[model samples]
Target: MKKKICVIFGGESTEYEISLRSAASIINELDKEKYDIMTVGITRGGKWKEYTGKVENIICDRWYDDSLKDVSVDLGGADGALIVYGNGKLEKVKIDCAFLGLHGANGEDGTVQGMLKLAHIPYTGPDMLTSCLGMDKAYTKIMLESAGIDQAKWVTVNDYDRDEIMKKVVDAEEIFGYPMFVKPANAGSSIGIGKAKNRDELMSAIDNAFKFDRRIIIEEFLSGREVECAVMGKRGVVRVSCVGEIKAANEFYDYEAKYSDKVESKLIIPAEFKDGIEKRIKETAKKAFIALDGKGYSRVDFFVNEDDGTVKLNEINTLPGFTSISMFPKLFMHEGFSYAEILDRLIEIGME
Candidate 1:
C-alpha cells in the first residue's frame, strides 16, 4: 500500500506565503509512485482547508482561493483518519505521516507538532520541545548560550506598551549602541524585523516587532558574511551540510530580500573559509543541533567575519524553507544529494 502523506503548509504566521511555496516544492519532489499525497493549507486567519489541486496553484498563491474543503487534524479521536470535516461535511481521512513545511509562529512553534504527537502520527521536522526552542529566538539564544555557543549580543523584552518598550530599548542602546537589529522573538522571513540606527528607528522597529509577537529580541548588528549550514538527523547521529553564504540585496536579509523577485539575493555554495574555519563551523553547527536536542532536520545560521574568521551563531531553523532557491536544499545539493534524496532522508528519519 502506498503511504498516505500529508503535506501541511500555510499558517496564521507571517511566513504564510513562504509556506505555500515550500509545500509546493515538497509536493512536486515527492515520488508519486511511493506515496498518496494530501495537501493541507492553513489560512492567515487560521482556517484549515484541504486543497487538492495543481501544484503550480499552490506555489503561485492561487490555491488559497480554490480550496475545496474545510479541514481539521483530529487528534482527540484517532481511528486512523487524522483529518476530519470538509465542505461542511464530516469526512475522515487517514494519514500515514505529515511533512510540515510551515515556518514561523504557531505551526513551527510546537502547537502542531504537539497535536501530531498526541494523534500518534509521525511528522517531519523537529519534535515539540525542540520546535519551541528553535522558534523562540530568545529561548534558543539562552539555551545555546548556556551550552557555551558563541552568539551575537542581544536583549529580550516582553512588555506590550510603547513606554515600557522604549525603556527596554534605552537599556539596549546603552549595551549594544547604535545600528541594532530588532526582531519578534517568534517570527520568520524577517517579518516584523528592522534595523535601527537611532532612537526614532529603534522605537519604530520595536513597534513593528510587537505587531507580530509580544516578545521581541534586540541585538547588536554584527558586520560579517551571512553563512548557513543544514543539518539532518535524529537521535545522536547528525549530518551537517556544507556551509553556504548569503549576500543580501538590502541593508540586511529582510523580508523583501528573502521573497521578492525584484530584490535579488545571492547564495554562494561551499562558502570559502580559512583552514580551520569551515571545520569549526561544521562542528559547531552539529554541536548546536545536539545541544538543542533537535530531532529530524534543521538549518543553523551564522555570521562569519571575513577579516579575522570570527563566527557567531545567528539562529536555528527547525523547519527551514525548501523553496527552489532556499539554502537548505542548495547546501545539501553541493554535497551530492539531490533535492529528492534529501526529502527521502527526512521522511525516513521522521518516521523512525
Candidate 2:
C-alpha cells in the first residue's frame, strides 16, 4: 500500500495565504504513482479541514469549503486520527507522514512539529529545536554569531518595555544608525517590516511592528545584493543549490512583492558574482544550516555589501516558499532537479 502524506498548510499567521500557495506547489510536485496525497488546510482561525480536491485546484481557486473541523488527538487513542468535529459529525483520518507547509507562528515555530512528534508521526522539515530556533531572529542571530557567521546589528523589543521601548529605540539608532529595518522578530514574508529613515519613522515602525509581534527587532539596513541558497539533506549529507539573487521593485521585499504581482522580484539562478564571493556565500549558507541543526530542507538568505564585499546572514526559512516561481524551488530547478523530483527527494530523505 502507498504511504499517505499529509501536506499541512495555513495557520494563525500573516503568511497564511502564502502557506496555501506553498502547499499547492508541494501537492502538485508529489508523485501520485508512488504515494497517496492528502491535503489538509488549517485556517487563520486555527481550524483544520481536509481538502477534497487536488492541491493545484485548491490553490488556483479556493475549492475547499470550510469543513468546520477541529483536529484533536487523544493520548489514550492510537496514532491514527482521533476526531475532527466537522459536517456536524466526528471523523477519523489516518496519516502516515506529514509534509509540513505551514509557515510563521503556531506552525513553523515548532508547535506543530512537537504535536506531530508526540503523535509518533514522521513529518518533513526540521525537528522541534531547530524549528523554534529558526523562528526567533534573536536566537538565530546569537547562534550564527557564535558560529563566526556575519549578520546585521540589531536590538530586540518585548511587550513589558512598551514605556521604555522608545528609549531603547534611540539606543538602537546610536548602535545601528538611521536607515534601519524594524520587523517583528518572528514574522516571515516581511509581514511587519518597515524601513525607518528618521526618528519619527523609527518610532512609527516600531509601533507597527509591535502590532504583529510582542517582541520586535530593529536592525541596521545593509545596502547590498540579496541572495539565497537552498539546502537539501540526503542521509547525513547536505547539498546546497546554486545561489539565486533577488531584485525587488519595492522599498524592500515585503508581502506584496513576495506573494502578489504588485512588485517585480526577479530571480537569477546561479547568480552572477565574483567567484570568491559566491563560494563564500554558498559555504556560509551550508554552515548556517548546520549551525541551526536544520534537516530535510531549508532556505538561507543573505545580504552582501558590494562595496567592501562583506556578506551578512539575513535569516533562514525552515519552511520556505515552494511555488514554482518561489526562490527555493527555482534554485533547485535551475540546478537540474525538476519540481516533482525535489518533492520526491524531500519525502525520501524525511523517511530516513
Candidate 3:
C-alpha cells in the first residue's frame, strides 16, 4: 500500500511564495506509484486550504483560482489530518508522514513541528527543539561559541527603545569595525538582511530589520568566500555533501541576489580548495550541526577567508530550500544524490 503523505506548503511566512514554488517541484517529482499525496496550503493570512489543483498552477501562483474551491478541511478530525470537505460531505485522510515545505516564522521556527508533535504524527526535517534553535540566530551563536567553533562576532538587539538599540549597534561596530550585517533573528531566505559599511547605514539596517522581527542579529561582516554544505541524519551517523560556493551579484548575498537575479549570481558546485580545507569544512559542518542538537537535515553556511583560509560558521538552516536550483538540493545532486532520491531519504528519516 502507498504511504499517505501530507505535503504541506505556503505558510504565514515571508518565504510564502518560495514555499509554493518548492511544493510544486516536490509534488511534480513525487512518484505516483509509491505514495498517495495530499496537498495543503497555508495562506499568508494563515488560512489552511486543501489544494487539489494542478501542481503547475501552484508553481504559477494560480492554484487559488479554481481547484481550491473543491476542497476544505473536515472539522470532524480536528487533530490536523489532511481532511477534505467536498460534495457536501467530510473526508479525512490519515497521514502516514508529513513533508513541510513551509519556511520562516510560523512554519520553520518549530511552530508547525510542535503542532505535528501534538497531533502524534511524523513530519520531515528536524525535531521541535532543533527547529527552534536553528531558527534563532542568537541561540545558534551561543551553541557555536560553546562548542569552540570560530564564527563572526555578533550582538543581538531586541530593545524596543530606539536609543538603547542604537547604543548596542554602535558598540558592535566599535568592537568589530566597518562593514556589518543586520538580520532578523528568526527570518530566513535572506528576507530582512542588510549590509552596512557605515554607521548611518547601520542604524537604518537595524530599523528596517525590526519591522519584520522583534529581535535582530547584528554581526561584523567578514570578507571571505561564501560557501555552504548540506548535512543529513544526526550526530554520529550524519552525512555531509560536497561544498558549494555562491558568488552574489550584489554587494552581499541579499534577497535579490538569492531569488531574483538568476543570471547575475552564480553557484559553484564542489568548490575547489586546498589539500585539507575541504575536509576541514565538511568536519566543521557535521560538528556544528551535531552541536546544535540538529536532527534530520540542514544546510550549514560558512565564510572561508581568502588570505588565511579561516572557516567561520555562518548559520544552520534546519529546513533549507528544496527548489530545483536551491543550494541544499543542488549540493547533494552534485554529490550523486538525485532529487527524487533525496526526497525519499528525507521521508524515510522523518518516519524514524
| Leading candidate by lDDT | 1
Better of 1 and 3 by lDDT: 1
Better of 1 and 2 by lDDT: 1
Q: 1-352, model 1: which lDDT tens digit per residue?
A: 8888899998888888899889999999998898899888888888888887788998877887644687776767665356556566687787878999898887999999998888888899899999999999999999999999999899898864555766787789989899999999999888889999999998898888888998899998898889999999987999999999999999899889988989999999988888689888899999899998998888899998868778899989999999999999999999999888888888888888
- Candidate 2 lDDT over residue span 1-352, tens digit each: 8888888888889888788888887887788898888777777777677776755665764755754356665344567443556667876667777898888999999998888877777788899999999998888988998999999999888889888877888789789898999989889989999999999998899889989998988998988999999999833589998889989878788888777876678877888887489889989989999998889899999998768989888999998888767898889888899898988888877767
Pairs of residues at least 3 apart in sequence or in different chains that clash in candidate 3: none
Q: Could you give me the TM-score of model 1 versus the true structure?
A: 0.95
| Strongest candidate by TM-score | 1
Instruction: Note the Cα lDDT for every prediction shown.
Output: 0.88, 0.84, 0.85
Colliding residue pairs in candidate 1: none
Model 2, position 291, has a per-residue lDDT of: 90
Report the error of model 1 at residue 26, Å.
0.6
Model 2 TM-score (2 dp): 0.94
